[model samples]
Target: MRFASIGSGSRGNGTLVQDGDTCVLVDLGFTIRETEKRLARLELAASAITAILVTHEHIDHLNGVGPFARKYSLPVYMTPGTYNREKIGLMPALELINCHQSFAINGFTVVPVPVPHDAKEPCQYLISSGSSTFGILTDLGHITPHVAEQYSRCDGLLLECNHDPDMLAEGPYPYPLKVRVGGDHGHLSNSQAAGLLSQIELSRLQHLIIAHISEENNSIEIVRKEILATLGEWQGYLTIADQGTGFGWITLN
Candidate 1:
């Protein structure tokens, strides 16, 4: 299995996961043209995607899903609560998923784990192909015990290290907006993400991708410090998914 991201940040987000002949997109936030260009950078054609799995209804994650799916004639899967029929317009193929259940999409087994985000029915994904498990975890505020347990044995993980508490506290956002962002239902702070890294089985992980960073409230230096502080001597590969152009494909063997 291999996974790559087109972009990841507050402005937009999209990730591509491929296993054999099946390639799926977790979310598409860029415009149709932007998505196409980004895919080309990954040496992929837009038509190569077999489906799209939406996590929530946030514009940064849902903006291009509708148009992209319609253009490519791809199947889309998401929890009913996350689906906005009117907002998304018409779909070529729609599959309503139960957040609590696991479903098969060709060669992959997708497990939708519900997360604590302010969106209607947000959920991250754990995709398994044979013995290789790759997890796409982002947008959640805090790590739940259930989430921790479910992600305990991932081979590759794309984790959200959204912001630094100190930076967020002093940033330009208004008080209420700051409160909401730092709240229990908002994005995870750098320390919170480090806390999750510590709790998981770090030995089994091959790739640790820091994702969903806030452009204004966080920086590469801050996230680096937290990750280094938590990783200690662990020698797994580490890369930050960029908002402009996300990192290249990392395969799990």
Candidate 2:
């Protein structure tokens, strides 16, 4: 099993997870043209993707889903609320997923864990192929007990470290937007990400990718200092998935 990212931030977000011949896209935030370009960087073509799984209706995650799916004639899976909340035009193949259920997509087993975000039916994914499990969690406010337990074991994880509380509180966003971001239904802060790291089984985690960072409210340096402080002497790889070029493909053997 292996995974790579197209981009990770408020502007756009997409992740690719593959096992053998089956390659699935978690979300599509870029235009069809941009998605193709980004895929080319990873030596991939859009037609090679097996399916697309959507987490929510947020523009940064749903923008390119319809166009890309229609162009490629690919199957799309998402919760019904997410599909109904947004008019993404006509989808050639759409599958409605239950947030609490685990389903199969080709060789991968996808577990959709519901998250507390400001969306209709937002959920993150835990994808497993063979013995390697990869978890992707983002755009959620706080970590629930269910979330903690579900993500405790993974070979690779893409965890959201969206902002620093101090920076967000003093940033240029409007008062309501700041409150929304720092609120219970908003993105996770760096400290919160570290706290979750402290709870999970870090020994089994081979790679940890920090994702969905706020361009206006957070910096890589700040997140590094904070997360590294929590990581301490942990031996796993720590990678930051930036808005521009999300990290390259990392394999799980």
Best by lDDT, which number? 2
Q: List, residue by residue over 1-253, the lDDT tens digit for candidate 2.
A: 9999999999999999998899999999999989999999999877789999999999999999999999999999999999999999888899999999999998999999999999988999999999999999999999999999999999999999999989998889999999999898999999989989999998899999999999989999999999999988889999899798888999987
lDDT of each: 0.93, 0.94
Q: Which residue runs does candidate 2 get wrong by more than 4 Å?
A: none
lDDT of 1 at 31: 94
Number of clashing pairs per prediction, in order: 0, 0
Can you give the lDDT of residue 126 in candidate 1?
97
lDDT string for model 1 (1-253, tens) is: 9999999988999999998889999999999999999999999988789999999999889999999999999999999898853379888999999999999999999999999998999999999999999999899989999999999899999999998988999999999989888989999999999999899998989999999999989999989998989999887899999999998999987
The ten-residue window of minimal lDDT in model 2 covers 39-48
